[model samples]
Target: MSREYKNVISQIFKYLAISLVFMVFGFFVGQRFIPQEYIYYANRIIAILGVLFVLLAIFSRKRIIPSRFSMNYVYLFTFIDGILMYPLFQYYLYDLGIGLFVSIVLGTAVLFGVLSMVSSRKSGGYYLGLGNILFAGLVGLLVLGLINIFFGGARFNLVISAISLLIFTGYILYDISLIKYSVENRFIKDKNDLSIHVLNLYLDFINILLNLLNIASYLDD
Candidate 1:
């Protein structure tokens, strides 16, 4: 691999490590002492940090060439997402069944992985061709699914989760491929741009993982 590729890989690893640390810390705190209500707020705080990290990544991109800080944002977002999902997953796992949750999450991850590979080779043709169409469909599905959820329905939720896993997984692959290409092409020449890409990819990965985890937990239940 090229130096840039190596750098990117290293950055990913670093971020993953940092995320694990935070996840562990958060888990312990929540399990040991934090009240349920406070835990919810804590998760929100982490989420807010995630948003701030994204903003910083964007602003930083405009000022300097890409650096390690760019990758740091990716790790930050991953940690935040992991933290938020812990409690949410705990709450929903009992109702969803583990097998179903796993199926959904894995399905989503696979979808994104395939789409990312396609998007990379086609130079966004996938985005223009099928990506937008899928995105619109997903939005419509989400709306309908929300309605179903509100009406005390399970079918819509299952359908939506299944479809979402597919759609979002494609998104994950596309987003990650874009990030890799940007780094390779030198479009991400500054810290901010790099950070933005990292953050985007990190979010994509976390979403995929969380969805899969939810599916798995649901199936088990």
Candidate 2:
């Protein structure tokens, strides 16, 4: 890998590690410290704050807000992501047991590692052109998800989970490929850009894990 490519990857992973720490901390606090009576309310508040921060970061990117704080907004949004995921993870861990949970987590990690490696190759740009296609798949998944919420079935959920797994896994490749492309083309101009890359990876990892868990759960049912 070129030095710049390596540096960009290193910075992205460094920020990813920090985000994971906050994720774990948030999960721990949600599971162990928050009172049962307040858990619902806490999640609501966290979700709202997550949306607000995301908008703030977007606006900052558009120059509506000072760009200097955009990276901070990204980090803060990631911390909220963890907390927002707490209740869902708790439900799965409790309903399906730790064995399934651990297996899904390991599966996600392995898949992420493999895809990242593939995207780090010199020819990674092959995946770079997939951004628009993968995004369309993602949008389709969201529409299917909402439709299922009203006309839901275990089988429907399984199908969505299966499709979503493929899409998000594809995203891992695309995001990593973009990282390599960005470095080679000098597109990553600043720390804020780096933080956005990290956020994309973070979301990809989280979604993969969630979809894997959903698939396993549906299959078991």
Candidate closest to the true structure, highest lDDT = 2
> Each prediction's Cα lDDT score?
0.51, 0.69
Q: Kindly report which residue stretches of model 1 are placed more than 4 angstroms away from their true locations once superposed.
A: 1-6, 33-80, 91-130
Worst 10 residues of 1 by lDDT: 42-51
Model 2: ten consecutive residues of lowest lDDT: 42-51
Clashing pairs in 2: none
Q: Return the TM-score for candidate 1, rounded to 2 decimals.
A: 0.58
Query: Deviation in angstroms for 52 in model 2?
Result: 13
Candidate 1, residues 23-110: lDDT per residue as tens digits?
5565554445545554344323423433343344334333343444645555554555455545654444444657665566567556
The local distance difference test score of model 2 is 0.69
Scored by TM-score, the top model is 2
TM-score on alpha carbons, each prediction = 0.58, 0.81
Per-residue lDDT tens digits for candidate 2, residues 67-102, read 234666666776676666677677677657999899
Per-model C-alpha RMSD: 6.7, 4.6
Give the CA lDDT, 0 to 100, for residue 175 in model 2: 78
